[model samples]
Target: MIIIGERINGMFRDIAKAIREENGAVIQDWARKQEERGARYLDINVGPGSTEPVRVMKWLVEETQKASDLPLCLDSTNYDAIEAGLKVCKQPAMINSVPAEAAKMERVFPMAAEYGAEVICLAMSEEGIPKDADSRVALAMELVATADAYNLSPDTLYIDPLVLPCNVAQDHGPEVMETLRQIKLISDPPPKTVVGLSNVSQGTKNRELINRVFAVMAMGNGLDAAIADACDEELMAAVATARILLNIDIYCDSYVDVFMKG
Candidate 1:
């Protein structure tokens, strides 16, 4: 499974303070730590903490790269902010998202193609989040078709089924899993399926337990990647174990140690 570290976002208090204070050390440290904790990519988000999002995004990207070589997932609702970070990225990065909206796709897809970057397509559009697996899959198909139109390969496109908080949307858990399973059948290669893993347990008492269990369950339904809190050791360990059980990893007594060290 691909891990995109979600800890560098300014939504967190420490991260918001770091961004506001222009603390490169804090940002870079989180980047390095997430990479050491087994994240293949770091997600950088300025969130609502910044008044100058574009400039701050550029700074965040540069600071993150100073400590870790992992590619970034430029995450912002602000298009210019995402573009600013992309401009300074030394490696091919990913755009954290584009909803399945026509105008947004027209902008984001070409930019991704030009920068040799990947894209995450949220499985919703102007109408709103769908209530069922079939609707999510239908939106995913439209997203994949749009990416293809822009000459982006299926492998470069990630379809996010948009899992909501299970506390309120209990039935959504199984629906999202079904969406993941069906998404893989959309094409021969299939656009990868991902979810914001933390969303499953938002506001729940057993956050870590819920996250770990849900992550493993999602993998069973063909989840290929996740935006997650890599700092959660138990969650990462669970992912390693799940990978082995699924025959995606060679198991050994030290498998968890080996996976975490990566």
Candidate 2:
């Protein structure tokens, strides 16, 4: 499974401070730490705090690249901010998202194609997040169709089933897993599946435990990637173990150690 580190986002106190202070040290430090902790990509978000988000996005990309070579997942609702980060990113990056909405698809897909970046397609539309797997899959299909029209390959599109907080929407957990399973059948080669894994545990007391269990279960249901806390050692270990059990990784006594090392 691909792990995109969620630590560099400005929503976190440390990251928000770093962005505000223009402190490259903090940003670069987190970038290196996430890379060392087994993140395949670093997600850079200026969050909603920045007034000059485009400039901040470029700064974040530059700072992150200074410490780690891992590609970034440029995350922003602002199209200009995403494009700014894309412009400065030395490696090909991933767009954090475009919804199934036509206006968004028209803008983000072309930008992704131009930059040769992967994209996360959210399985929600203007009507808001669906309450069931079938409705979410319908949006996923529309996302896939729109992306195809812009010449974006299914392999490069990550379909997010939109995991809601389990506490508020307990029934959504199974629905999300079912959506993950069905999303894989949407096309030949299919769009890759991902979830903002932390959302599963949002507002919960035992957040880590919730995230770990849901992550493992989601993998079983065809999750291909996650935007998550890569620095969570126990969580990563659980994921490694689950992957081995699923035959996605070869098992060895030291498999967890080996996986962490990567």
Query: Model 2 over residues 68-105: C-alpha lDDT tens digits?
Result: 99999999999899999999999899998999898889
C-alpha lDDT of all candidate models, in order: 0.92, 0.92
TM-score of 1: 0.98
What's the lDDT for residue 77 in model 1? 84
Q: How accurate is candidate 1 locally (lDDT)?
A: 0.92
Q: Which stretches of candidate 2 lie over 4 Å from their true place?
A: none
> How would you encode candidate 1's per-residue C-alpha lDDT over 90-200 as one tens digit per residue?
999999899999999999999999999999999999999998999999999998898899899988988999988888999888889899999999987889988899998
Candidate 1 clash pair list: none
Model 2 lDDT at residue 84? 96
